[model samples]
Target: MDIVNYTLKEYFDQKKSPCLSFNVFALDKEHEEDEQKWHRSDYFQVLLLQEGEVSQGIEHRNFDLLKHQISVVFPHQINALQMGDNAKGIVIQFDEVLFCSDLLKNELISYNNDLMHKLNHVALDEETFAKINHYGVQIFELFQSLSPIKKEQIRFYIKIMLLEIIEAAHQNYQGFRAPDELDYFARFKTLIEANFKSKRTVSYYKDQLQITSKKLNEICKNKTGQTALNIIHERILTEIKRLLIFSGKNHKEIAYELGFDSPSALNKFVYAKLKETPSELKQELSKIYKY
Candidate 1:
């Protein structure tokens, strides 16, 4: 399915999560180009490489994903299409709520939550592939056999697969975060998304969590090689840029959406963070993204 047009509700109806969906195809046997831009609202995706190669992107980084390797795409992140002469894989998609209906379970709150928030795209070997796929199929079969009430059972199956997914993703994934510091940064990021427009101060976030700014900065730096304020600046700047380039909203509207005091305030932040005027940034982004 071309998923960009799909909201969370559409996915819920089709896949019936707690759900698991899987399909394996050979690179040589079929050819179809997907034109629909795809992004998810509240689901996680893992594309397991089957053969040949495909160039894809996650959050703007291009990855040449290959056989037995995997890439995890988180909700709300832009998922670029796989394109090339030869491409093969099984793409798996699941909702965040697959683990439990409670939604407040500690497993969901602590490690599982932070792990999902970390967003790793890693490669795996054949044996590792077989291991995760075993759970993947288990969830798939359970989902296939489900009636309405059995969704709970399917959720448990997904919880099991999610554990396996975590193991598979972190086995040797390299990109960001030390294992110990991962949760703090992950939570900080989640909160940023939840509150970026209203809470731009380092102290605001630190106070919200009852931690000091120093501790937050340390965690963010260790995990992402960026300071907390830097991260905040980037997040706000990115949204401003997105609004400027992708939407027809004027500066006043953009400022209001971003919770800036005024258009002038937003423009100052834009110039301070990006070294360019808002209009110039829009022009540049437009030229680069002229698809």
Candidate 2:
């Protein structure tokens, strides 16, 4: 079973102009049918459910979103949506490069960390839901227009939406405050993203961050409820899963690509973390998407 990988342009029906970094669509029957299959995209996605309910699966987790709820899916996360007949919403997708000048990478990392233990959906109050609906409509309209500054306008609207979600998360998690070691942890996360494929050692990450291994583990445990070693292992596991499902490569090839010494080593790692062999996991996922 091969996982569907959607690039921004391919997902938006703008393949002729692959340079476009963003797209917006209404959650109608047409869009719903197109998105019913399990797939992963190279861009960030936000789905605003205004009317009916939606059940979405991201990675191995399932999220049921009620009316007036919003769900954010990060890049490369496996996703599929099941919607009711009366579902009324808008889907917003954007490439990360569009926000490079906005310094949004760090903010997004922090925001994701805040939502780590919660469902990806944010349940909005009536007033906040109405406000977000207004912005979603405006953004969709702008995306459909030929205005020269439409992209800029759309980016502005997205920033507004993100700010609102950040504020809401802050309010919902009032007991959680930014730890003093946030900067250190953020840097560590950034490094993990960049080097996880080639580097998987806590000591290597600690050396990169100029911290002792014990201190790094303490920071990770305090902030993320995981040790530094666990964080590294999880990152590696995520990449392995992504490749196993989406890369269409054989086990030997994947093991070599991920710097594993041998196929058996990769197999052992997968079984240890997921309690399933790679082939078994793939077969299970195939059954899921086959539905």
**TM-score list, all predictions:** 0.50, 0.60
Cα lDDT, model 1, residue 144: 57
- Report the Cα lDDT for residue 94, model 1: 55
Scored by TM-score, the top model is 2
Give lDDT tens digits, candidate 2, residues 81-199.
89987888998887644433324545566565545323266777878878877888899989786354776678788888867766665566545644345478767877887787789
Clashing pairs in 2: none
Lowest-lDDT window of 10 residues in candidate 2?
96-105
lDDT per residue (tens digit) for residues 203-237 in model 1: 88887767888999887755444689988887787
Worst 10 residues of 1 by lDDT: 18-27
Query: Model 2 off-target regions past 4 Å?
Result: 12-15, 100-103, 106-112, 115-119, 173-203, 206-291
